[model samples]
Target: MYPLIYGGDARILEEVLEGTHPGLSSLKCRFCQINSLNPNLVKGKIVLCIGHRGGSEAAWSAFLAGAVGTVIVDGLQLPRDFSRIYPCLHLALVQAMVKELPTTSAQQGTGDNRIAEYNIESGTSMACPHATGAAAYIKSFHPTWSPAAIKSALMTTATPMSARRIRKPNLHMVQAISILVQNLRLVTGDHSVCSKAMNGTVWDLNYPSFALSIPYKESIARTFKRSVTNVGLPVSTYKATVIGAPKGLKINVKPNILSFTSIGQKLSFVLKVEGRIVKDMVSASLVWDDGLYK
Candidate 1:
């Protein structure tokens, strides 16, 4: 199951609840206590329980009430150590809502007939399928591509969650498909196949994310080599841009401009890093922006 950590924001959670489950006017006493719940009302349905006591306790009560699944949401900031005992999802105050709730209907159906059914919930669990589906679609076209290559395509092409100001995977199927097609051609060569097959370091993995870690009281310089296979039209050039480099650190990318003459042609570059000693963490990103692609 895909797990998501919600940011701490009480107002956002309340806003989500007001829109989706309007009937749920009160969260203070809703399923906060086991004795407060009516089994008939909760049976066979997934329960959204308040995490006043704790997620574990709340989940147990929901299970006892015959809920198919449980969602624990509390307005307070909590540690990320909540255990996954059942099919349960925890939402932070910031990640208040992800699921699209169904609109309530006033008209009731006749006997032996039913109206449309709507299941509204939100979590990384619900979001994971979109990424998986994108992967599956790519696999269908390039049955010969290895899992690593497919993963690289997805990671390298994903949109950064900068708006949320968080470092995480935000899946975009259209972009993934485009990148997969281009990456397939680039990695199809005999020389590119080996590197594409093996797993590499996070920064050098052709991933969509960038991360740099410098241990406390340590001053060091590091260099990384990254390769790109030309899969687009022959004889195209791409330029690299570095943004948000941490202060007190020197970062450089050699041969920042890449030119490819043929499909499967490989180009390698070195990223040199020299930095002063740091007490806390430092972060930055290097992006390749081709004329047609970002």
Candidate 2:
């Protein structure tokens, strides 16, 4: 059977199959009864909620109800969103505005006729401000940190978020090249230094999130480069783990063990992924964990 679990990763499925994550079995409930949902039953599980607007309402409500994730069967997956990042994140404000906003004719209606929707709106307004504030906060503490470094701090230190579909079309876009590689040689591995940008793929950009958009049942390999700064205890060691990958996937992190000797020290790692697309969408995450910190 096709894996129908929305926002579910391989690790989550493995746990449920092994009877480890019993709370993950799908739960279908009425939207009107969201408040009545028993958290004890929903906790650690992924809830299925039918949504009419942007799925945030269901996602946010389920998040507050303690669900690990949510599946919103809606008319469309308009505006990509995942509850994993921040339970209340609103990347765009259009969804909330469209809900409560009245049409031109309705605005002039009698007071008794107009429907009133009182909502604690959540969207980009909240998220943008939070990011800006957080970035400013990080800047205040480390005046020497560059904007990119500050950005990395927020990303690498923040709690894990949800995943999205990665465009994995096999078609390669042919672009006009002004400069060619001196030797027409392929650059392999992180150590291979190339002055040209053609040697790298957009997917390998150093970002906190990962997404795979591969055709079904096709094998592929990709690599990403990420660096983390030592902000915690000195002389601490950290290791990387791949969590929530789909079946038949293999992830390797080179120099798996990160040992830091001083604060503000930065170390980089190359994460290689090997796997075939078993489904239309594949999602996973890499975690760097120390005994004292995640």
Tell me the whole-model lDDT of each prediction, alpha carbons only: 0.56, 0.58
Q: Model 2: which residue pairs collide? A: 84-161, 85-161, 90-123, 90-124, 168-213
lDDT score of residue 171 within candidate 1: 48
For model 1 the TM-score comes to 0.51
lDDT of 1 at 272: 81
The C-alpha TM-scores of every prediction are 0.51, 0.48
- Per-residue lDDT tens digits for candidate 1, residues 1-294, read 422221111112455546764544344435334333445555666556655564545545555655555666555454322323344333333342333324431112122122234322334675567778899998998787677768767876775444334423344536754555447766564333323445566567554354556677566687777777776678788898888766777788899999889977989888888877454655666877779765
TM-score of 2: 0.48
lDDT of 1 at 226: 77
Give candidate 2's total backbone clashes.
5
